[model samples]
Target chain A: MKKMLLLYVVVIGTLMAYLYMVYFREDNGGLSENAGLHGKTDERYVMVNFLTGIDYWKNSLKGFEDAAEALGVSVEYRGSTQYDVQEEVMVLEQVIARSPSGIAVSAINSEALNAAINKAVEAGIPVVMFDSDAPDSDAYSFLGTNNYNAGVTAAREMAELTGGQGEVGIISLPNQLNHQERTRGFSDTLAKEFPKLRLVGIEDGKGDQLVTEQKSLELMERYPGLTGIFVTEANGGVGAGNAVLQAEKIDKVHIISFDTDKGTLDMVKSGTISATLAQGTWNMGYWSLMHLFHLHNELAEPMPDWRSSDVPPLPTYVDTGITVVTESNVDQFYAK
Target chain B: MKKMLLLYVVVIGTLMAYLYMVYFREDNGGLSENAGLHGKTDERYVMVNFLTGIDYWKNSLKGFEDAAEALGVSVEYRGSTQYDVQEEVMVLEQVIARSPSGIAVSAINSEALNAAINKAVEAGIPVVMFDSDAPDSDAYSFLGTNNYNAGVTAAREMAELTGGQGEVGIISLPNQLNHQERTRGFSDTLAKEFPKLRLVGIEDGKGDQLVTEQKSLELMERYPGLTGIFVTEANGGVGAGNAVLQAEKIDKVHIISFDTDKGTLDMVKSGTISATLAQGTWNMGYWSLMHLFHLHNELAEPMPDWRSSDVPPLPTYVDTGITVVTESNVDQFYAK
Candidate 1:
């Protein structure tokens, strides 16, 4: 009898221990600690943009690569060599043919690339937009600066530089949606917030150095009291700075510009531009890849038929963010 | 000798299989399939706000609770019964004493709550701001509507409704930062884009229904040509709607309002208010918790000594997002 009792106790004891190990470990939210925050090495992602040769893409690409490294995945950077919508569409079509795990695109023209993006989505490939967006397309999310807010930031910074009182002008790419919003924001904030700061003239720079310089000169002549100027693009910033320098009005005029391109940063350093608004380009790249990974892996719970659904699994828009870069902090923006 | 060789081969084969399972499983992001997208049940997060009784906070709180549930965590909602800054500060202090996993706050005053927020951060707790923000505070991230952009969205909607023409007026809480930005956005966009849509007057609503109605009447009386009115808060929206309804000017005037609170939604549904701007309040709650979770779990790579560091581990600002709600879409916004 004693031997039989001992055998029963041992059997029950072992069973109890096994059950405890299987059912009672609650430290990891019901998941094994080793089961998260990584992906397969073969899972490939691609980023496509127009005007691929500009230094503007350096930070964004680095961010994409960094995210790929963190997630243990591979990434490729592809885009049209020229700034043509048709070329970009063709490149996207080719990328969709290979059907890399996912694609992040900066559309050259908002409406022109919808067909290609839609085709990729219909084929079960996930897509997200960055920088420039095709809003009507089926992209899961848009990661970029709120250009209007960027304009507001610039206006605030300009107020601080110009002591909230001055005649200001804008040199912008009027044809582009992003620049139009920026110009509106800068002009509006000035009208409402700084009663004394008058926006005198807005001239299109055509996004060219010489044209921007000419526009800056013309604006200065039209409003000689124009003590402040805001350039909505990097090349225009340098152009406006040159105009101010040649006119010997560097001290008399203050300028705020956009982006952290090397030329723009150099102007900021030399006080040709008082400050520039730097978009969260790196965040755009990194978060775009992250969003793509989540969707591709089905880790982010998508709404039922999310493309046609009222809501999406991911945030529809992620404001990558913006910061004001002035002489004090401009050095950190320089590429190492 | 053949039998001995067979035994050696079997043993070596078993060892190789074990090694492969441990080192080469690449299906996951180098993690176990069951790991990630979850957290511990015992971990608690708290959401703090100023007006605890208002309907404005319902969606945001729901979002916070939803995120907590998804993460296998618990959440507590706490706030001041009144709008007093001191009361909010004290409530936050109380929340800090308990040392929950993280805290999300919607600050009442832009500058008054900085010390309390910094206190929470100093105590080695993760903090994020949602909805309203104290920009100078040491919170890890701010997830809120970019009020300026919210204004811009409203302005565009107004243009669409008014056929980009006619006189419009604003009724708003001018003292509040959010409303000021909205008013500025509406007025600025009107002045720039809709040259024929003149912003004839701006009246302080004091966030009161009767007061707003009186102001609306005053505005309409003063500017007989006024064909549109934008109210920057829910109460004022309904009030403005009532004024138009009573004056029998519903057909002549279009109203654009802010928020999707029940009152606002009902008005939109009834066609009393032509449209309202629906802020990404839910996104604010969800992303705030996500940010705090990453910070608490050390999943987000923070700058060394991020408290004093110029850089943070996470994105500093996130524009939760915004959308337009008219009669056709107002039903979708009603809380189930």
Candidate 2:
């Protein structure tokens, strides 16, 4: 009888202990090491951008997915189907409505998505910006290439190509901060160092291929002696390449463009286009999620005496490095 | 007492059955549905290449790693530390001795490593060639850019750049079959399509940038009216670009270079190089491993009349494809 009583007590006590550990774990979240094994995650992160299918987003998205896999969490990709700022804003609003654990966004316009991004952070969701950034937003970090430094690199490369003396011009998007910064960097660098290279003018490509082509043609026409032209974006570079091809000025007027899109790479390979700068796209996606993960897990402590306990101690910006692609290593840039 | 004995027997048998199922599952490979759990991987695959640390191998290695992760298998990167063919042969022999599940190699020399590669096949290990191939060997498939077509593309692009009129020269490595094919393609294409564009000579660059530069200078000196030159490799292309730069014929001498290396890309960006050809390097590494995995798992079936049971019914050649990089989209080629 005593032995039977002991067996009953031992079994019941084991069951109670197991139940208590599970209950405590669920209540506290799996932040504790002694808590041991974890279950299928309740955490889901989302990446928001414009023109979701473009090759530009591929590397970044891969990084984000890799980070998600490493963390044993789920991730969803959301963006405007088209290249519209308003559409991206709507997408952000929709993503916020889902109330994901965290969000990483590449803003189409600097200020257009600020309200939506802020609202998510206000609702206790972590938001991180990548590629294109929104400066005024309450996001944890801006992870992307340094647009200004990219322009400076372009300027230096251009001087090398042009022998530090010639009439030069810029074909760029006028309103976008990234584009503007690139243009400013080029203009500033040229003015500061290669004083012999004169800036003819800056023409807005409007980030359209055909428009960039036409604008570039007009610039070449306006400045017949233009030795170099720096295109601030990928489409603009291709457009400029087309203009050079049409003009039969392949060897005369050097063209420096931005980004490593298929069209631009083709032009560079064919000799119609000059060189292009490639961004560290993968880093942006990987680190954005890492920042969000820390924020969501509350592993990153908030700044001392801060107004709220939400702020993550991540840096404001991450400068993903750039690579210069030319004829020699052009093959490496293609999808391997 | 008999009733108690029967109860004890039933309880012990039930516990033993449960424990038996768990133990049997833990012993077998995770191929069964009920044994759904996976631990630190027991499977290991490897990639072998030469000049292992060069930027050229980065995309291919990444693809191999990515495929390994997708298959829930572990992968190792191994290769000749230098660009030595004999070293590569030794590396292959060592890898074969380890008797890995499968192997993927980018052959440094066409026929030198055939014996080692064949030995691996004889040992019942699967082998696939990527980038530079050994066609006559026992390797299952070749995944790389079609060199002849790439040369033809360069020829056509050159014709367009030069307007089908001018004397052209080629700077290439004559010993390499890939380079030989490229040179032949360019010579044939130009001879057939553009009668006026004369091939003054094909000088061997010896796959050295400085040698290519010297040869390009000689070509220019030999034919002062030389309007276009085709370089059958990356180093040769950069050398040709430098020759043009020194000649100050940026407006007159058009250069068509092969491959996308940093120096060539820089020259192209600067308009010193007309264009470059980009290969699908990532596809080679990814597909090779994926193919090997299928072979290892017995997922790919053998051909009906094939001599060996080890063969996978994959294509003889993959033709990874190529892209043209130019100024317009040169930036896109950079690593983002």
Best prediction by lDDT: 1
Alpha carbon deviation, residue A4, candidate 2 (Å) = 23
The TM-scores of all predictions, comma-separated, are: 0.73, 0.49
Alpha-carbon local distance difference test for all models: 0.82, 0.77
- Candidate 2's C-alpha runs over 4 A off are A1-40, A302-307, A310-312, B1-11, B14-336
Task: Give the Å error, residue A18, model 2.
Answer: 20
Residue-level lDDT of model 2, residues A287-308, one tens digit each, is: 6776687568653322342226
lDDT of 2 at A264: 85
Minimal lDDT window, size 10, model 2 chain A: A30-39
lDDT tens digits, residue span B1-336, model 1: 556456556555655664465345434323543333456656889999998999889878888877776566789999998989899999999999999999999999989889988998999899999988898988877888777777777878878888888888889988999999988988888878888888888889999989999999888888888888988887888889899999999988899988877888888999999998877777778778878887787655323454454545576677766768888767777877
DockQ of 2: 0.01
Candidate topping DockQ: 1
Query: How well does candidate 1 match the true structure in TM-score terms?
Result: 0.73
| Each candidate's DockQ | 0.19, 0.01
For model 2, how does the per-residue alpha-carbon lDDT over B144-260 read when each residue is reduced to its tens digit? 777887888888988989999989999888988999999988999999999998889999899888898899889889899999999888778887888888988888889988767
Candidate 1: Cα lDDT at A316: 70
